[model samples]
Target: MVFYALGSKFIQEKKDRENTPPKAQEVIYYSLAIGHHLGVIDCLKPQITCKVAEYDAWIAQLPIDGEARRKLEGVKRFGEINIDGTHTHLLAVALHHSLPQMTEQQQQWSRELIALLQRMENEPAIYLLVRRHDDW
Candidate 1:
């Protein structure tokens, strides 16, 4: 899961560098989505870094090809896993990042969401399920 997140971040950076859009649109989309999931994980486990730089270095060695991109697209489309409340989790992270200036109500909501995420992250089964990615 950590590797997927780091790889996705690397891919997003690669895509951002190109002036033209990536030929594999689905790959880019799924990369960003997975990266977002990583962000949520980071929020839950603030102390965990997962050697992201090492993962990025390893990901740089991989070749991006049509077949791989198609597989990623298929995983994104056909994978049965459903992640609920991701939007709310994202919103909480966003609000937390925007702290100090955020309204009291927003801050309270962010704290509540973070608490809920912490609980979810503590569940061994949920953690195992979320960490599994068929595309990898």
Candidate 2:
């Protein structure tokens, strides 16, 4: 009885594998897989610096002070986009850098900033002159 059930389960799993969906979209700046599921195989894998001066105005309006404010002023650099589709998927919080490169402190800052931005009716859209791309 046990063998029979095991065989049936194995067959079902094989059938399921045959029908799995294609891979989900990849993370913007890295090989991180965001939406992969049952069918796709798991291939596990594995910054410049800049100053804050250019962003002075944008930072002034942030409503943050002290360390939080200082860190924002200290970021050196973020990316080198050599991979496909990698140019677009970075977490807005990490700049153009991959998620893994984000330090624990940075992560905390991201969360806090995200929360703060969420509350500001217009802050998220505010442009950062320092950013090379869009205003923000």
Question: What TM-scores do the predictions have?
Answer: 0.26, 0.22
Q: For model 2, state the Cα shift of residue 92 in Å.
A: 4.3
Pairs clashing within candidate 2: 28-89, 48-77, 49-76, 49-77, 50-76, 128-135, 128-136
lDDT of each: 0.36, 0.29
> Which tens-of-lDDT digit does each residue in 32-87 have in candidate 2?
22212232223211111223433343333333544333444443242111111221
lDDT of 1: 0.36
Candidate 1 stretches greater than 4 Å from native? 1-92, 124-136
| Candidate of highest TM-score | 1
Question: Candidate 1 lDDT, tens digit per residue, 1-136?
Answer: 2211122233334446475355555565454445444654442222112233332332232234433223213323543223333333443454455446545543554465455455445431122112324334
**Against the true structure, candidate 2 has what lDDT?**
0.29
Q: What is every candidate's alpha-carbon RMSD to the true fold?
A: 17.4, 18.6
